[model samples]
Each structure stands twice: as C-alpha cells, then as structure tokens.
Target chain A: MTREGWTRLGLVAAGIAALEALCRTKVIKPLTLVPPSRMVHDLAGLLIAGDIFDDIGQTAIEVGGAFFLAIVLGVLMGAAIQATPRLRRAVAPVLASWYAVPSFVFYPLLVALFGLSTSPLIAIGVLSATPAMVVATIGGLDRVPRVLLRAARIHRLTAAQTLWLITLPSALPSLFTGLKLSFAYAFIGVIAGEFILSGGGIGYGIAYAYESFETPKMYALMLLVLIVAVGVNGALHAWEGRLLQRRQR
Target chain B: MTRLFDSLAIVAGILLLWTGVFEYAGDSAITGPLQTFRFAANLLGRADFWQHAQATLSAFGYALAISAVAGIALGLILGLHRFSGDVAEPMLASLYTIPKVTLYPLMLLVFGLGVSAKVAFGVIHGMIPVILFTLSAVKNIPQVLLRTAKALHLTPMQTATHLLAPAVLPEIISGLRIGFALTFLGVLIGEMFASQRGLGFLIINGINSHDVKRTTAVILIVITASVAANGALLALDRRAHH
Candidate 1:
C-alpha cells in the first residue's frame, strides 16, 4: 500500500481506539456522544432498515433540481456577459462583491416566496450555486486561446459554427468546475434549508435525532452524509478527469 | 469614464427590470424598489437593526480571529512535516467536503446556544480553508528559495518572517477571503437556527410575523454590509499582491 494509505489507516485506527477508551472509561458521556463502534452498528441497522432512503431521495432531488436550474441560468448569464465584453467588465465587480454575501440570507426570501416546501430548498441551492457557475463559465471561455479564434476566422467558419466547434470544447474544463461547485453548494444550501425549514432531508434527520436525543442515530446520519458527499464528489471528479482526457485527444 | 457609464447603465437596466417584475407580481406585501429603498433607509436609522448587525459582525470577527491564529499555526506545522501532511491532508479535505452545518447540533451540544456556539461554528467553517491554503502554500515553496535561505545561515524565525511569510501571503489572503465568507455564513446559519439575537434572528422574526418589509430591510442591510466588507478585503488583497 502507498504511504498515504497506511498513514490514513493508522490515524483512523488510533482515533477509534481513543474514542472507545474514552467511552469505556466514562470520561465522556456516552448519552451525548456515541462511541465509534456503536455509530457503525447503528449505521448498519439504518441501512438494513432502508427507511432513510426517502429523506436521501428528497435531498438528492432538491440538489439535482437546483443544480439543473443553476446550469441553465448561469450558463445563459455567462454567455450573455461573455458575448458583451462591456457588460462582463461592468458586472465583474458586482459579482466579486456578491461572492462574500452568505447565500443562506436568500433562504428567507425563498421561503417567503415558495412557503415551507421543497421549492424553497431548491431555490436556495440555485440562488447560491449560480454565481460560481457564471464565474467558471466566463473563466473557462477566457482561457481559450485567441489564436484559435483567428484560425477559425481564417477558415471562414461562421460565428455559430466556431463557437460550437471550438469555444465550448475549450471551455469544458472550467464549465465542469462550475458544475462541480454548483453541485456542492447546492447540496449545502438544501441541507441547511432542510434544517431550518423542517423539509424532509438528511439534514432534517440530523436535527430530529438531536432534538429527541438520539445521539447514536444522529452520528449515524452524519456519517451517512459524509459518505454521500465523498462518494458524489469522488464520482464527479473522476468523470471530470475522463472528460478532460477525451478533450485532449 | 465610459466603463463607469456602462456599469451605471447596466444597474439602471436591472433596476428597471426589477421594477417591472415587482409591478407584474403585484404583491402588496412585497414592496417595489422605491418602497424597499425607503424601508431599508428607515431600518438603517433604527437602533434595533444596528444592534443586530453588531451582534452578527462581532461574532464573525471573533471567529475569524480565532481561526486565523489556529489555522496558520497548525497549517505551518502540518505543511512543514511530510508525515503529518500525508496523514492529515486527506482527512482535512474530506472534512471540508462535509457541510459544517451538519455539525451545528454537535457544536450546540458541546458549547450550548448563543454567541459561543455561533463562534465555534464559524471557526470550524473558516479554519479548514485557511489550513488547506497555507499547507499548499508551504508545500509549493520553491526548493531553491529554501536552499538560498539555508546557505545564508538564516535563523528559523528569520526564514519564516522573510522567506516563508512573503511566499505564502497571496495564497493566505485568498484563503482568508474564502474563510471570511464561510465564517459569515456559519454565524448567520447558527444564529438562524438557534439564536435569540443577531441579524439572522431579526430576519427569522420578521418572517414569522409575516413582516415582509422588515425581512427585506434586514436582507438588504446584510447584503450591503457583506459586499462592502468583501470589497475592502479585495482591495487589501490587491494591494498586498501588488
């Protein structure tokens, strides 16, 4: 095994051992904090029962819907701005400043508009994710060599043809980055919305467990969230890598 | 000057579109731009808005300060050591992927509700980026630069101050920018979920009471404050990089 793999395994093992000892000695209250072993056991039970699937499905749908909205709106906005250099230059400062605004602030507005439904969650995700997508789209396009466009002009290619054949492909990496960012941000927004709005999601599950003092269940759910996030991100990254390689060829 | 005009024109265009939308929606509760501006102006004059704004900003400040110190220190340690970096970087990256919001209940369990809990949440939100940025900065330091510093028989402290610090400042600033936004979001979310005070609480209170004007006013104030703060930070970062 690679050194990094061994190091990670050793650290995880040590962490688990420490937690077990802490729980066994009653140094930490097991009621408030479940041991790692118990957490794994509870997670297995929940997976076997499969009741959490509903919440997982709801959250996934919200995130996916939001990401879809962001991609459509953000790409259009990005394309519009890029097509007009003047507008892009004018909006750059505004976008940069907007980046600092905590996206959750928009949730109240969404809830006000959409009420206590999954729509608000999805809206929150879209609102937060769009900026990243727009920025990435612009950046990706900007990185496309000017010489290539000149070559396209030399070849007597129409603007539409040149854009379809060259610009989009060249900007694929940055576009993918924007998509990745949108997905992650959308997921966070949806989860936070669920926590606040009592929407059905893993976030709501965590909150529910906490309120009822189901410490082990809460831990299990948090672990599940971690796994899902890691799994999705890993999958997306691998997909991005393959796309980039294909573009190179 | 033309660029300024272009920006003004765009803003005007957006405002016109926004007004049209507001008019079309025809919701008496959701005010148009003029009313929103007037109401937001009134909110700015109110002591309550200022108090809530102070609460939010103070929490943000406290968390940012704590995280900056701890993140830089720990980042330096981990970055300088191959063994630690190999062990901890993956863990840190994974932790970053998990929404810090998920850990709020845990934070509340440990710190209880109020400013401390919010600050703790904010620190966790902010610190990871700083650590990751700093670690990468340290890892990316040119070997030639280190060799030059060594040949000069520079002290460790000197090396840190003169060589390492300047080399990493740009990345650190970028990290700080991300950290500030995340910390602000963390504090805002924390306050929204469980606090009795702050801008978030005000917004929630406004929402619960169905006071659209108040909620809109608070949102406006927050966005303005956040944008203004971000602009200042961007200015600072630009100056440092230059």
Candidate 2:
C-alpha cells in the first residue's frame, strides 16, 4: 500500500479509538451511540442467528432487479439518443438538469401506481440509477476515436462488427464507470425507498430499530451497510485500475 | 432560434407523456398535466403554501452557505497539501457512494427533530462535492503561476485573491451547482422523514391522506423550481467556463 493509504488507515483507526474511548467513558451516552466494538459484536450475533437474512434477501433482489434494468435501459436509451442528432439536441438540457429534481418525491406516485410492493422500490431505483449510466454511455460513445472507425471501414467491416470490435472496447472504461455509479444509485434508491415507506428490508430494519430505541441494533445495521458499500466500491476501484492498466499496455 | 423551438418541443413532449401516463394510470395514481399545472398555480397563490416553501428555502439557504464556505476552505487546505489530498480523496469518494439515508436516524438523534437536523443532513450531502471540485480546481492550477507569484513575493492574501480565486472560479461554480441540487434534496428528505413543515412534508402528508392532486401539484412545483434554478446556474457555469 502507499504511504497515503497507511496514513488514512491510521487516521481512521485513531478516530474509531477515540469514539470507543468516549463511549466507554460514558461521555457520548449509551442512548446516543454504542462503541464500535459493541456494534460489530452485535452485528455478528445477528448474522449468526440469521435474524436479518430475509430482509437482506429482499433488499438484494430489489437492488439486483433495479441494477439490471437500469443498465439495459440506459444503454439502449443512450445509444438511441446518440444515433439521432435532433433528439439529442433537444434531450441534452433535460438530461443535464435531471438530478436537480429530488426524484424521491415521485416514490409516492410510483407506490400508488404499482402498490406497496418491492416494485415501487425497484422502479425508484431504476429512475435514480439509469441517468448515470446514460450519461456515461453518451460520454463513452463520444470519446470513441474516429481513427478506429476509419480502420474498421478500411477493413470492410460490417456495422455490427465495427460496434463490437471497435466501439465497445473503446467505450468499456466509461461503461464500467456507469456500472459502478448504477450500483451505488440503485443501492441508495432501494434502501431509501424502503427506509421512507416500505415494510421490509435492511433500511426498514434500521428505522424500526431507531424508533424502538434499539441503539445497538441500529448501529449494527448501519455498520453492515457501511461495510458492504465500502467493500463493493473498493473491489470495483481495484478492478477498474487493473482494466485501465491493461488497456494502457 | 432553433434552440428555443427544441426546448419548447421537449416541454410539449414531457406534457404529452404526463397526459399519457394519467390516462393509463387513472385518477388515483396521478393528475393530468393541465390539472396539475392549474393546481400548482392555485398552490402558488395560497399564503400557507408559501410558508412551507419558506421553511424549505431557509433551511436550503443555510445548508448551501455552510457547504460552500466550509467546502472551499477545507478544499483549499487539502489541495495545497499533496499527501493529505491523496489520503482524503478516496475516503470522500467512498462516503459519497454510500447510502447516507442510513445516517438520518443518527442526525435526528444528535440534532433532534428540527431545522438544525435538516441543515446538518444538507451539509453532509452538499459539502463533499464542493470540496472535491474545489480541491481538483486548486490542484490543477499552473505551477508556473505559483512560481511567478513566489518570484513577485506577493502576500498570501493577495496571491489567493488575485491568482487562486479567479483560476478556480469556474470549477467552483460547477461544484456549487451540484451542491445546490444536493442540499435541496437533503433538506427535502429531512423534511419528509421528520418535520411538520416544508413542501416535502406536504407531499408526504398529501399521499398519506390520499390527496393525489395535492401531492402531484406539489411535486410539479418542486420539480419546476429546481430545474429552473439549475438552468440558471448552468448558464452561469457555461459563461464562467468560457
């Protein structure tokens, strides 16, 4: 690891240690926060007891469905827009300002349309996630080298062959960024939807715990979310780095 | 110009889509675009509606102010220090990706159920983007410029005001635009979950009470306001970049 990495780790450790000390000394108050160690311990107990497995499974399915749909739809939409110059010109400003609107405001409308099932959660997830993928797709497509297209034409390649061999490979990095963003947005959307309105999932569990004054359980759930999010992001970052390195070579 | 016509066309397309959705989904799910606009206009006319809007606006204002000032200050420090910036950047990025909704309970507990909690939530959401943008902007400043400043023996304040501030203005504006949206989002989410006032609360309350028209109208108003604000900022951003 790099020196900066080590420094960051040290800083994190020191911060956690400080929190633990404060909790142990009764300065932070047990009602407000538990020690990090206790939170981890409680999380392990919950996992061993299989108490949250159903919630985890439900969240996973919703997130997976949303992520899959967003990627497929976003890529299609992006490609379609790219193909039509007039449509792209009209749609560009809308897409640019899309995120400015708080999309969560539409969750109730979705719930009313789809009923209070995982469908609303998944729909919201797709709504939030798809735009990132679409933006990335457009960016990637825009950056594809004209020289590569020229080479493909000189080789008498079919249109599909040019797209497959030249366009796709050239656009892979940006598409991967889209994938990462889509996952993050999907995860956030589904969890937030569940948190605000739904009757099930990890988000609901945390809200329940909080409302019932189960501080330890709430913290445990929070810790689980943090770990999963950070772990997935780190994996993607490492994979992207390797992929880019190989491309450079 | 063609651009104005294209924009008008897009608006027409959106209204058509909304009408189509209303026709398919029926009255229970959504309002017709025309009805929604009429309802929204009525809402704008009501003094009580402005109270909720004011509540939201005030919280948003505080959050944006705190986020911009703190983010720029912290970003400047980190950007000037290469190792610290390297250490902090990834951590901040990871935090950005995480589901921060999970921390709402903690914010509520710490700040209690009020505007302070809302402001705190907004700051957390909005500040990071500003910090990241400002950091990169500062880091990307020409080394020659810094060397030139050093050669001239300009005071620190003079160097910052005359050199660093102008150089980073465009990127900072871009960041502020993003921060504005996010802080607005954060404030609304905060209202939706805990508060008794604000347009977010009104939307949620309307849904709970089965007032679909009110909910739809409020959403339409909020979306229109945010998009218009973003459009204005975007224009400024483009001008700054040029």
Candidate 3:
C-alpha cells in the first residue's frame, strides 16, 4: 500500500481501538453504543441468519427501478429542453430553484397515494434524482462543441445520425458524471424514504432495531449500509477512471 | 419581456398538465392548482403553521451555526497539513458516500427524541461538505501566496486571518450554500421521523389523518421557503464570487 493508504488504515484502526476501549471500559454506555467487535460479531450472526438479504434485495430493486426511470425520463426531458433555447431559458431558473427544496416534503403525499409499499420509496427516488440527471444532460449538451455540429451538417449527416455518433459521444463524460450523481441522490432518497415511510430495507431495519432497543443490531445494520455505500462509491470511481483512460487513448 | 412571457407560458403548461393528470386520475386528494392555492391561502391565516415553521427554522439555524464553526475549524486543521489531508481525504470520502439519514436513528438514541437530535442530524449532513470544500480551498491556495506569507515572517495566526481567510472565503461561502440546503433537509427528516413539532411533523400528521388540503398547504409552504432561501444564498454566492 502507498504511504497515504497506510496512514488511513492506521487512523481507522486507532479509532476502532479507542471505541472498543471506551465501550469495554463502560466509559460510554453499552446501551447507547455497541463496541465494534461486538457489532462485527452480531453482523456475522445476521449474515448467517440471512434474513437481512430480503430487505437488502427490496431496497436494491427499488434503487434500480428508480434509477432506470430517472435516466430514461431525465435524458429525454433534458435533451428536448436543450434543443430549444427559449424553453431552456424559461425553465432553468425554476429547475435551479427546485433543486434546493427538500423534495421529502412530497414524501407524505407519495405515501398517501401509494401507501407503505416500495412504490412510494421508488417514486421519491425518481423525483429527487431525475432533476440532477436532467440538469447534467442539459449542461453536457451545452458543452458539446458548435464546430462539431457544423462539421456534421457540412457532411450532410442526418439529425439522428449526428446526434447518435457525434453529440452523444462528446457529451458522454458529462452525462456519466450526471449518472453518478443521480445514483447518489437515488440511494439517499430510497434510504430516507424507507426511514420515514417505515416499511422495508436497511433503513427500516435500523429504525426497528432502535425502537426495540437492539443496539448491537442497529449498529450492525448501520455498518452494512456503510459497507454498501463504500463499495458502490469505489466501483463508480473505478469505472470513471477506466472511462477517462479510454478517452485519453 | 419575452423571457418573462416564456416563463409564464411554461408555468401555464405545467399547471395545465397537472390539471389534466388530476382530471384523468380522478383522485380527490390530488386537487388542481386552484383548490391547492385556495387551501394554501387559508393556511396563511392559521397560527399553527407559523409555530411549526418556527420549530423547523430554529433547529436549522442552530445546526447551521454549530456546523459552520465545527466544520471550518476541523477543515482548517486537516487541510493546512499535507500529511494529515492525504491520510484523511479518502477516509472522509468513504464516510461521505454513506447516506447520512441512516444515522438518524443513532442520533435519536444519542441525543434523544428532541431538538438536540434534529440539530445533531442536521450538523452531520451539513458539516461534511463544508469541511471538504474548506480543505480543497486551503489546498488550492496559490504557491505564491504561501511564499509571500513565509517571506514576511508572519505568525501562524497572522497568516490564517490575513492570508488564508481572504483567499478561501468565497469558496467557503459557496460551500455553506450547499451546507445550508442539506442541513435544512436533515432537520426536516429528523422532524418527520420522531419530532412532536416542526413543519415536517405537521405534514406527517396531516398525512396520517388523511388531511390532503393541510398536507398540500404545508408542502407548498416548505417548498416556497426552501426555494426563497436558496435564491437568497445564490445571490450571496454570486456576490462573493465577484
């Protein structure tokens, strides 16, 4: 490992050690805080029990469904808006302003309409994330070089052909950034929806454990979430890195 | 004038779409804009809405203050040192990826089901971006500025206030805008989960009782407040950038 990596590992180890000591020594109440070792042990037990997988699967399916919807709808809407300067000007301020509002305000309405099912969660995810993708798509298309369009026109390329071969390729990098952001938003929305709506997923698991005062299980569930988040982030980072490499070549 | 007309046209188009959807779906709960606006206007006269708004805003304000102080301090400590920043950057990034709302239950446990939990939750959500942005701002300071500071034999405190603060203020302000938005969202979520008061709780109560008009009104209020706050911040950010 690099020096920086070693330093990070050391710091994390130190943090864990301190927490273990704090919990073991009873300086911190075990009722409120579970030591890392115990949490890990409990996590292993949960893994063996395997019931957590159902909740995980449910949350994953919702995330996937929401992300798909966001991408499809967002791209189409953004592309259409970008194609017209007047439309873009009309909507840009509204969209920018909307981005700041906590869309969770709409969550209650979603629940009222859809009930305590995964549908509400997925709907929230789509609503929260689609805007980011749309904005990114518009920005990406805006960044495409005018000269490229001129060249395509000179070559007598059909609008569809020019868009598919030239515009999309040029905008791919920005769109990917948007996709990554959309995933983060979707993940957050789904988890928050689960927490508030209280039906399924790791969020509900955590809330359930908290209500029942299952400290160890609660911490373990939190750990599972952290692990999943870190794993996905690392994968996304690696994918972006590979794309950048290919683009360079 | 044309832009104004265009914007109004788009707004009209959206209202028309919503009306069409409501008509087709025939869901009484999903009322048209006309009824929704009337309900919202009625809510303006109610004292309960303002009380709930106060609760939400107070929690947000306290959380923002704490995070701003804590984030800037931690950011400076970590950012000013190359070795510490390199060691800490990846760790922070990993933590950042985790959905912070998942930690709300933990906050409730630690701080109890009160304003404290809500404030703590908001701080957690808002503080990370501030710290990361501050760190980057510090790291990206021009070498010439640092060299000048060193050559002048300025004390650390002198350098911090005179050199570092001015250089990083704009970026920090911009970061605070995001921090403010996230913090507001966190407070809202916290209120929704367990609070007995706040705009979030008001909406949740409205939903639980199936009071569509009240819920819609609260939703509209929340949206308007957030959008207005964000617009103000955007203006401030633009001025700072200049």
Please report the candidate that would top lDDT against the real structure.
2
- Candidate 3, which CAPRI tier? medium
List lDDT for all candidates, in order: 0.83, 0.92, 0.84
The model with the greatest TM-score is 2
Residue B130 displacement (Å), model 1 = 1.8
Q: Is the docking of candidate 1 incorrect, acceptable, medium or high quality?
A: medium
True contacts kept of each: 0.49, 0.78, 0.70
Off by over 4 Å in 3: A112-116, A145-173, B17-31, B145-166
Off by over 4 Å in 1: A148-173, A240-249, B13-29
Per-residue CA lDDT of model 3 for A55-171, tens digit only, reads 989999988999899999899999999999888888887777765788876676677567768898999999988988999899889988999999999999999999887898788
Kindly list the per-residue Cα lDDT of model 1 for residues B46-117, writing each as its tens digit: 897788889998998999998888988888889899779867886786677777788887788778889999
Model 1 clash pairs are none
Each model's DockQ score:
0.51, 0.77, 0.58
Superposition error at B225 for model 2 (Å): 0.9
Backbone clash count, each prediction separately: 0, 0, 0
